[model samples]
Target: MTVPLSRPAIPVLEAGMPAPDFTLQATPDQNITLSELRGAPVVIAFYPADWSPVCGDELGLFNAALAELRRLGAQLIAISVDSAWSHTAYATQRKLHFPLLSDFEPKGEVARSYGVYRAKEGVCERALFVLDGNGIVRWAYVSPITVNPGVDGILGALEQMNNSTQQDTP
Candidate 1:
């Protein structure tokens, strides 16, 4: 006999809106909020968990593309329901330099705010939100439970947004 398995649905965050602000604890008790990075674009990636296989590969892609992301004048942040200790351990193991914020206590508060929390799974789905310098969400993507987001797609969207802003100025 065999049984079928199911995964929770992926949630979506709409574009062209203000991203919900959150002050999650990162490594060493440091706090991160959307408002602090007001002058540069920010990419917030919400993944299921720290030690999971897909989560590991997704974060690794970001780590490997750090230089490119920086050159685009953007900062990358990964959020999960894991505790700071877990995030620290994962970052160390993966050699990931970017901040991985912890949403552990309330257990998916930030994820729910961002509309990415999978209540049944007790974690967030693979979601990406790109907020402009002023904290306005410029683009968003939500991947299926079994699919991974395209890193290049995110970078490309950022590039397009950057270009459009420049054109609008003069």
Candidate 2:
């Protein structure tokens, strides 16, 4: 009998590490550079695809939580191996107000840099990275592909980051 091997477990980013910066297509016409958003909190949601059921639920939750995320000084961006065209269609269909970045072409390079790319599956493992204004990761979590990790964790991390940042300032 032949045995099939499971994919290697991908690692999640650790808190206090500087985030990896990348320029990615956010729409059919626009591109965004991660480092350009410095001086503001940024939340990166890396998922597998555009139209998958779990992805839809997760992205929609972020969409609904947009105001709360903004109030906490966090800007959310959804990244996937999906193409810019795919992201554009998916975002429009879901009325997602946030940018959906395409990790296509070089495909998963950014995700791999963050240690969230699944090589065997050719997709980004469902993961979250919340970075503070200084671009240091405040929190991160990688969930099962079938699960939605929820916004509470992200919000809590944002609060903690805010407290720490305030303490560091005059």
Candidate 3:
């Protein structure tokens, strides 16, 4: 018989909280601001680092999902504590078209604000936040650091939000 294992749960920021606005380095010369991407759904992926094996596969999966995500009027912006240069190299190697914002310098400050920082590991816990066009968080999830958490939950949130917006339209 296999014994069941359990891990401590990490809390995720609750849905309906106003996503704290932030501007972070996206490239050597460019910065991305959360508020600037309004008028479309935004998927914020807070992962641990740039080159971890799981992180690479997780982001690669999102890269593959970009078309579907865009069709729903959603943009994917991944945030990690890695520096801009590191992010650039990682994105190049991974062929990721989405912006990978750096939470470097202060290191995990944005992750802390979102309640996803893993101080012991000096990285952000695996977390996902789906914000509506107006910048209110619609759904959130915290996954084990070694887990990917996939894109189904995000796709569900985008579909639900899109449907609601349609219903609200005249």
lDDT of each: 0.86, 0.90, 0.91
Model 1 scores a C-alpha lDDT of 0.86
TM-score of each candidate? 0.92, 0.93, 0.92
**Model 1: lDDT of residue 80:** 92
Among these predictions, the greatest lDDT belongs to 3
Backbone clash total for model 2 is 0
Residue pairs with colliding backbones in model 3 are none
**Error of model 1, residue 48, in angstroms:** 0.2
Pairs that collide, model 1 = none
Residues 78-140, candidate 1: write the lDDT tens digits. 999999999998999999999999999899888888888888779887889889988888888
Ranking by TM-score: 2, 3, 1
Q: Sort all candidates by lDDT, best to worst.
A: 3, 2, 1
Q: Please give, for residues 9-40, the per-residue lDDT of candidate 2 as tens digits.
A: 55567898999889999988899999999999
Runs in model 1 deviating more than 4 A are: 1-11
- Residue 32's lDDT in candidate 1: 83
Error of 1 at 119 (Å): 0.3
Error of 1 at 31 (Å): 1.3
